[model samples]
Target: MSRWSSETSKKFILVFVFLFLLYGCATAPVTGRKQLILVDPQTEIKLGLQAYEEILKKEKLCNDPTINALVQRVGMRIAKASGKNYDWEFKVIDKPESINAFCLPGGKVFVYTGILPVAQNEAGLATVLAHEIAHAIARHGAERMSIAMVAAFGEVLAAELLDLNNSRTRELFMAAYGLGATVGLILPYSRKQEYEADTIGLYLMAKAGYDPREAIKFWERMRQAASGRRKIPEFLSTHPADGKRIQALKNLLPQVLPIYEKAEHKYGLGEKIPEPHCR
Candidate 1:
């Protein structure tokens, strides 16, 4: 029947279009790894912006003028050297118990007050800002979301192929991608990506006139911070520890040392950052 043939042809065309879209993937900066990101950059940035606004609304901001100014100063320098064209904003959270820093996509950075004691000074804070900004410049969060989109797409395609009339499949797909812990815990970046961020971050910090070597010291302090940690929470579950991460950075120091030296020379030698120890 002509009508039956027309319907079959339409389905074929749809499948062809789906495959074409899948083939058009993008490469990650610095690492140059091919990624199957179904979502556009605009979509990813919108989500990041929304998430950032939600966090600021929920968290108590640090009221200290000096601390806020310091964070903003260092954050701006790093953002400039990141070579990324995005609306950037930095905030210092008043939370004293949680020692963490994060840079969400589209240049949203947050530094908890608790981490400042460990950072000790301006250069130390620069180290934290540099690493967090590296995550944004490298598009690590976007890459993770892209992976989730691909997984969800696969689930839908699989369900259709199986001829399964199940709403649970759609629900499960949402659950998998919706949970940040999903990729953070199980499927993380290739070791290559971790190393790439370190290398790229060092250069960014150096160009920003911060001592890149402080990153090494910062991680050492982080390792000491997590030494007695018994259990991993969903958030910490995704990131690698200070020891493995620091060692990798050390190995790449030879390549980045010149950048550090230039930064130190240009910025004038800064006082040595003091090491932190847990009581």
Candidate 2:
């Protein structure tokens, strides 16, 4: 009975915070999906701009003219297709060891040079850039911060209910909230966001005259590259397994393919990116 009462109290606290987040709902730009965005667009944009500045200060900008031109060409096409009048900028980071790329809110895109090998052509690069840009337009970052706040609220409630002074009890509270909220609520939400990004990215890339089918090829290459790496359990992972992601993209192709077929320029694979002797 004692344990049951405590469990019930925890549930009530989580529900309350969850409902609070729901009150600040916003719709995602491309998909029109309703999302819980605790932060306003202005605030999100401000934070993103600040973060982007900080990142630029820390990371060396790639001085390769060829790489810069390639990213700019693909990026501008996608940005125009998005139909959002964001002050957009595309840049390449000089990090050869990092396999990551991202777009900050309002369209600051930073691509790592290391990813160039994997994104062997313009279409492949389009897939990467478009997906990252999708995350920004979808306002996934705001939604994630909102969820994290709710998770933090749960921790506070647990601390009040349990004996915070006890080390064992503190451990229990931390582990329960940290692992449960992150792996349970956040991971599933992120997977959903990831799929949404893929869908929107296909549209943007196809509309930008890049081949949408190349997204699948890019992911297959990503899957192969990631094969030997240790994977987080699917239920606890933020991103879906590469195979699952590719399958979902395949299902969505019927919708995205027509957009590609009708594109005015239809630069199929566009230009082949030069093999990096930087490798």
- Report residue 206 deviation for candidate 2 (angstroms): 0.8
Error in Å for residue 34 of model 1: 3.4
- Off-target runs (Cα >4 Å) in candidate 1 are 1-24, 154-190, 229-237, 263-279
Best by lDDT: 2
lDDT of 2 by residue, 1-279 (tens): 699778976786766565556447788766789887555566557656765676788778887788888899999999998887999999898876656677877788988887787788999999989988888888777677566545665354432323324443323322222223312333234667888989899999999999999999988776665566575422224344466898999998999899999998899998888854332
Model 1 TM-score is 0.74
Number of backbone-clashing residue pairs for each candidate, in the order shown: 0, 0
Q: Which one wins on TM-score?
A: 2
- Give stretches of model 2 more than 4 Å off: 1-23, 154-189, 228-241, 277-279
lDDT of each: 0.62, 0.73
- Candidate 1 per-residue lDDT over residues 1-279, each given as its tens digit: 598777765665575466448533777565576765444466446656656766777788877776776678777877887778889888887766667777776788888777777677777777777776776666665555445544554234432422213433222322322233322334444566566667777777777787667778877766566667675422234445557788887777787667667653344223433332221
Per-prediction TM-score, please? 0.74, 0.76
**Candidate 2: minimum summed lDDT over ten consecutive residues — where?**
173-182
